[model samples]
Target: MQSIKLRIGINHCLTDNNDLRYNGETLSDGFVQHTLWKYANWIPVCLEIETDHIHQTLGCQSEHINDLSKKYLDGFILTSNSPRHDSFRPKVGLSKGGTSASNDMGVFARSLSLKYPALPIEENDRLHDPLIRENFLERIFTSKRWNIAFSNSFTPHALIQFHSSHKFLFMSHSVSLYQEMGRLVARSGLLTLTELKDRYVVLMSSSLKQMATPNKHTNVMQHIMGFLKGLIDADEKKEIVETIDQYRTGQVPWIVPITLLNLHLRKNSAADWVLNQTYLNPYPAELMLRNIV
Candidate 1:
């Protein structure tokens, strides 16, 4: 059972008040629901600024960002033309930064990314790309795992345990990073927990940025399937292999092959390690991240 609430902050500068009413796409809602599974409830936090109240109590750009981040864990920002004024505009090169207009609406999008570098941020425009969307969700789920695993303690044992669970996930992304992460964890006795965490997270995120291709995923999936070589008969093993091959060819979704492996896991106790490997179930089944790619 899960108790913590999962949140994704949405920061956007609305050109009109109608944007505040509703845009009417429940994909975000469903995505959260599926990713969190049924273990916990969902409370979606969104910040829409139609006008920047630089003089207003909550309209200050810094406060607006602080307040929004306080409520949500991660977020998306929508880009649009916004009226620019000196009061809220930076004297420095605002346009040169690749940020939008000088107004709060335009600039806050860039602020969110800068403020939360570890956050999985996607712009309203770029998120339309399948690859970008998948990457965002994958990073968000990784952030979720970090939140859960590191919430309580950062002892050496805890670090090792967390690393153990995620090794396969790292391997699927980058075997080199996997080995490097393991080496760092092995040195927990020599380094402070804080240092260990900081270094490990940077490397973890870097590795995941490599993008999990079909071949990489198939390799991890098969590696997991291999654990039960003798337990499953020729026919059953062949079925799983063919299913994974189909996924490699893009004939079926990742969920199909993974679910098949899970069934085998349930049938055999010898494959207990497969259950702990994050590669098998990194996020909730409902997310269907595997379904698309």
Candidate 2:
């Protein structure tokens, strides 16, 4: 089956190729690479423009904040100099040449998290890192899966099976989340499917966020490969070690080892269950997301 195309909400400036700073110029075409532009559907959101227009009608920023909550967005990638908290609340910048926090895109990075706790949000700055980009794409895909799964004829067994398939990812990325999922799975009989799914999605989003952070990078590769250490031959083992070293040195993308491991796993019938996992190959292989070095 093919992966669903995600609807990604992006900052207006990033989309329009404009820079919102006082004397800033236009953004380069390479701001967002062609691979991402071609892969996902981007919806530009000028929260500031909407804010400026609605400010007079609503008469208060708090009401505008409430209004922003109503927009339908799967995930948001905010550009730099974008308003933090979606409000130019503080006079951090001036119209002419002075600085403004509202105009500072970096300040607005985490605003979406506070506003929508379950929403997957990222900054354009962080996407330059392949690992972070991979994590962001993974989260949106999982978010869409969660949305579709819950909005359909979901059953308790399905939730359990879903948890089972994705449990390896949590185990590899976040042990605490792996344990939390285990505990939640145990309560499947007692809890409603909706309740369980809600809790599971929240934890899943949290786990993706946790793994995306820099601190978890070293352990993620180690954890996944650790499982395959005994299953592969000496040559495969050597390749994995070299791949991991290359990844550590930034000589290759983080996915090189994963792609290599996936290839190795595919050859062994004993690896069918692990190979069948959704998170292990979440995105379409056609995207070539894993193929690049």
Candidate 3:
């Protein structure tokens, strides 16, 4: 049998100890020496660090930002800080030859495109073919920008939503804002997992939830329960429970990854199961489906 060629990107904070484990190993455990071997099948993308000195006091340097972008990411998801609702809108360049927000994004996109033509650039706002123009009209009329920065920041729930349709997922390293935006994008359906199962899958960063939070001992159980309660039905619930049991038994090492779970939820098979399960309050399920649709 051929090995599955799926590229899964995880965006995370390098500083977070939990995030280090998702890369199949820890940073302290020979991250530098065994970098490729540790992340053998995954593409580790780092996120640009946003600090008080860089964003506030000294102002951001375009070269510094560009250099970071070049070194870490092939693509980026512009967003706001998580845990704290920091604004996604940055001042752009430094006191010297700094760029504006739009200009900076354009420069980054252009630079990435020029360097790696294979990677496609995607942001919250709609842009022209080359993705240079900010499309002020859409920005003014729609709330994609607002959703990008604040609501539904990066969570496994959000990634499940995103990979519901797209085959490949890309994540950055920085945790504050980009991951939050990635969550929103995944939820909003801007980034979807393609149904083409044969396509190559690529993930930029490592899995944040699995890495940052311990699998067996974390709040993820609560969150997963909430998500399952909100969606799963009697028959599907039985199946999911069985699957979870198998996961616990080590029969299935990775119980359906959250990405697949969300995709299953969106599919007709799970949808039918959901409709059949009568005990669940239909209102919340209805609302959730409506939001996704």
Model 1: per-residue Cα lDDT over 183-270, one tens digit each: 9988888987789888887888788777888899899887888788789999998999999999999999878998888888887875
What are the runs in model 3 whose C-alpha is more than 4 Å off? 1-222, 228-231, 255-260, 268-293
Point out where model 1 deviates above 4 Å: 1-4, 12-59, 66-106, 125-130
Q: Candidate 3 on 59-170: residue-level lDDT in tens?
A: 3334434554433332333222221111223334445556443322333334444453323233322222211212121111112221232244544454444343221111
lDDT of 2 by residue, 143-258 (tens): 76665665557777777777777766665568798788889878888888779877877787777777543224445556556667668888888888888778767677757767
Q: Superposing all C-alpha atoms, what RMSD in Å does each candidate have to the true structure? A: 6.3, 5.7, 17.9
lDDT of all predictions, in order shown? 0.64, 0.63, 0.32
Query: Which has the better lDDT: candidate 1, or candidate 2?
Result: 1
Ranking of all predicted structures according to lDDT, beginning with the best and ending with the worst:
1, 2, 3
Q: Estimate each model's TM-score.
A: 0.73, 0.70, 0.23
Candidate with maximal lDDT? 1
What's the TM for model 1? 0.73
Off by over 4 Å in 2: 1-3, 18-33, 50-72, 84-115, 212-253, 285-293
